[model samples]
Target: MTDTKAQTQAKSADAGHASAPKEHYDIVVAGGGYVGLSLALSIAQASDLKVLVVDPQPSERLRKDERASAIASAATKMLDRLGVWGEIGPASEPIRDMIVTDSKVSDPVRPIFLTFEGETAEGEPFAYMVPNGAMVGALSDAALKAGVDLIECDSVKDFAIEGGMTSVVLESGHSCTAKLLIAADGVRSRLRDLAGIPVVRMDYDQVGIVTTVEHERPHEGRAVEHFLPAGPFAILPLTGNRSSLVWNERTDDAKRMLDMDDFTFSLELERRFGKQLGELKELGPRKGFPLGMTLARRYIDPRFVLIGDAAHGIHPIAGQGLNLGFKDVAVLAEVLVDAARLGQDIGAFDVLERYQRWRRFDTVQMGITCDLLNRLFSNRSDILRHARDFGLGIVDRLPGLKRYFIEEAAGNRGDVPKLLRGDAL
Candidate 1:
């Protein structure tokens, strides 16, 4: 016997319920770190797009991170436009000037090879050394306030592009769908691997020892980078009489130093840190991150894209890792927003390729530059050292070239995106 019309309608509803996702969004970003949250905040603020961010950790947990980054002027501009830089800026320390020194660990005096007035031509500091916790906290809170959905304590387990939308499965077995899927999971991105994206990577066999130190004298907003045979030992000024340290060393040497007693470690730190900051005392805990450069072979897939560390992870030699990620967020957000306005599919290959085209060269160029800098500086060859020092001296003597380098470090060079240029989308 044939079913009644009402019964057929009820069965159809049941089928729909079985196939429909628990939730749907215009974009679902995996890994709600700085890049993911910033992307969500940008898109949510600029348009009515529904955005969701999934991460394995809660916002509070993310804020407990002890790391600090050198936030470039261009990034701060974007953050200000997003309305969260106010919270972050107050907690940050501007780099009023920067000096680069090339010397050996045994060198009694580290002669400054290059000096830069950190402020851009507009009288803004080229960069700020901001605590990671403050930046993450501000971005996370702002993203939430901007109406972006957040899912913590779980992450995107896997995903598949289907019928113009990407279906996502979370580790908790929860499922959702979105027009576009983004992976900001990090350098060792699980989502990137799942998507079959290949990467070009270089392990420097060096580790960056990150920590903070309290100095007897104030840093006066000056940053110092001592290019030693081990690597670049950067003393980035923080608020008060403190400075953040990014010390690079050979893997074995870093292991030994990290295992040293407090007194012994202080001596080791001082040998390179010098007496300019007066006495130095270690602050909080020290973290060692392996140095490397990881660049995804491609930045886009069908309805999928990568941002931040998932797309490229460069050496901290130039302190531009986070800045590169910010560039990604800016370009991608602008591309997607413009496409949405033009009534084009935001996740279409061509539309996504626009972002890839705009960002790919910049990312690769920066990665190679960092790699070369690391190689040139992190070595024991006397000839190479002299050569690099001569180059640095030339850059120092040429004010125009030095200004260009400062602008490059500020991330205001090249084809600037609207968000990065501090303009609204």
Candidate 2:
């Protein structure tokens, strides 16, 4: 956090150098993943900025993807601004309520330690379970509608900055220029490395197994998080009779459990997932993602900026990972659009620093909170077990405190950007 824009750019200078220009745009975003795609779409909507999204996958693959994201309420508003949420919202499941429990997977009784009566506002629930396919399909359609160009099956091979422009070269043997370059690539970001950005990487020695389950009985828009000894097992409500499951376990245990035969895996899954939801069946394929935390030393360097996972990767203990990326999207888009409207150089460190300064505190706070929570609850120590549950019980009894926590989880905390507040940029 102490690193200044000048120092970071100076470091980047030794790393990457740009030459000449050919096809030009107002902005060239590297990596057309969710964060990159959302930012590009937002920028294209707010300004006459010619934007290009470079990636290695076509739109069809994105649409057919099975991954799902917990879209915090604030992020839903941001997506609404980009004109995609409306298309996906219908299929998204609103989290009308939530329950928290603490116990071992082998325990007979999983006592509910805390409960939240949902809906932060009228007709607005705390969050929604939006499938990645719906988001990808909506964003792709919206991006095309907004006249944003898509360079599929290709990525930024490298890029250089000269004068006031950043020239980007693709692996497809093409070069283009943009006033500003942003890296929404991912947590393991090559652009971040090329820009000489250092990140604090902390591996949790755990992995999250994600999949959906269909239950015979309805969830009634309810969600549950059971903090077992291994990790938090979440039953997040989705559209219809299905719910998304994020089951975390130690790295070694995860590998062994996943490799088990279907009958064994279902039994293990049922242990964490109770019969309260009637019978349960695993839907589709299950995937495991290694858990870790990564925070870039700096968010901006020269004309290049980092957002989404490229900026920070926190634990899913709190479902705020995607929301944090959307926060970055909202603030960066506002800064860039305002600068361009003022006829200022969007790539200037002076202009880019404003976005960094706006976001750094919030990002760091969330990352630290998640890391601490994962440690606090993902254990069986008698002291922490009793301490955290006592804390949760107190919060549950206090209406005001519970509302504050709900608002925070909804990403409505602190000074939020207009777009996230459901306002147009």
Candidate 3:
């Protein structure tokens, strides 16, 4: 790992900002997506961090709710730290319970049905379902309140690591230098590439079809996960009896599915989904994304660190992608804030190493778990099918084991951050 703090100071000194009189910031976060924005806000609240957020999207036009949604628990706490949770609370939905089942077309039978109920020590629910756009809006508002600088409709045209500091040139012909540079630019991060950090990539040969649907009957705060031959079909609870669906299928089949008419799509969805919710109506257009995993060989270099999808991308089988990103924000924020409070070099390798140690294991575990689940369930083999269904049945019958799985799914069982534990940051 590179000592970001030393590199930052060295770069600042080389840039001679103190002597030349130029605009500089303590931290510059590239890519204003969920992870980037959340991190900027969290860091800004802890210190007069002088954070700058650079993105190509206009802030005013980023508020429209998208069909995509995330399962938030730990993420909620991170948002609370940034003071955006309350703003998005009204539009969010609580998931009180979840059902996991193993189904087969050959037998047309469900061999196992497992139900997990959520629990929270606080008055709040265990997890929330939030739309992507709503999350972005809340983060944007919180960032503004924290006095973080926002550079919209702009992208990093070039970045160079020299003399200990990283200099980034924006497409708008603006140049900025920062003690530390964090890339939340997503899985295909250009910055990470430019920094020469290689990633181990795995393609799952699967595609996730995501959309929201309104059912005749209320969801009653219950979500469902059906393990089918193609992949898992997850129906996450949303507000007003609506459910957000992430249906994973074969890559080639998914392309055809996206072109499916509403009537055909609804029928196909209902087949795996069942008619438990009575009649179902499509709420909006459906979108699909290819599923894959990517883990950067290194999480940090001198004056640079990766967060969110940029650091790791996993299958959505567990709906942990964004939640994991939230964890990154929480851990990175805590580490950086503590370092700053001690007057430690915030960009030093020592400070950045703390974050890497905290998150790397967790990220690898999650990636492997999701990959294994994808493999175990996404096959038509009878032996594996029987074993998985039997495993589900066994867990369902064991109360203690069932509760453990529930808590894990709810993002409550871990070395959690204070914000995730519902404490003030």
* Best lDDT among the predictions, by candidate number: 1
Q: Which stretches of candidate 2 lie over 4 Å from their true place?
A: 1-22
Model 1, stretches more than 4 Å misplaced? 1-22
Model 3 scores a TM of 0.91
Query: Candidates sorted by TM-score, descending order?
Result: 1, 2, 3
Clashes of each: 0, 2, 8
| Per-residue error (Å), model 1, residue 318 | 0.6
Q: Which candidate would rank higher by lDDT, 1 or 2?
A: 1
Model 1, 170-252: lDDT tens digits are 88888988899999999999999999999999999999999999999999999999999989999999999999999999999
Residue 172 accuracy (lDDT) in model 3: 75
Stretches > 4 Å off in candidate 3? 1-22, 105-112, 122-124
Model-by-model lDDT, in order? 0.90, 0.87, 0.81
Which pairs of residues collide in model 1? none
Worst 10 residues of 1 by lDDT: 12-21
Which digits, one per residue and each the tens of the lDDT, describe model 3 over residues 1-425?
A: 66584575445334321212136888888888888988888888877778888887875567775665665676676676567778787888888777788876444665446877765545556678887788887787667667677777777778777677778788878787888889999989988898899998999888998888889999888888888899998898888978999989999999998999889987887787777889999887598888999999889987889999999999988889988888898889888888888988778888999999999999989999998999998898989988877888888899999767656766788798766776655
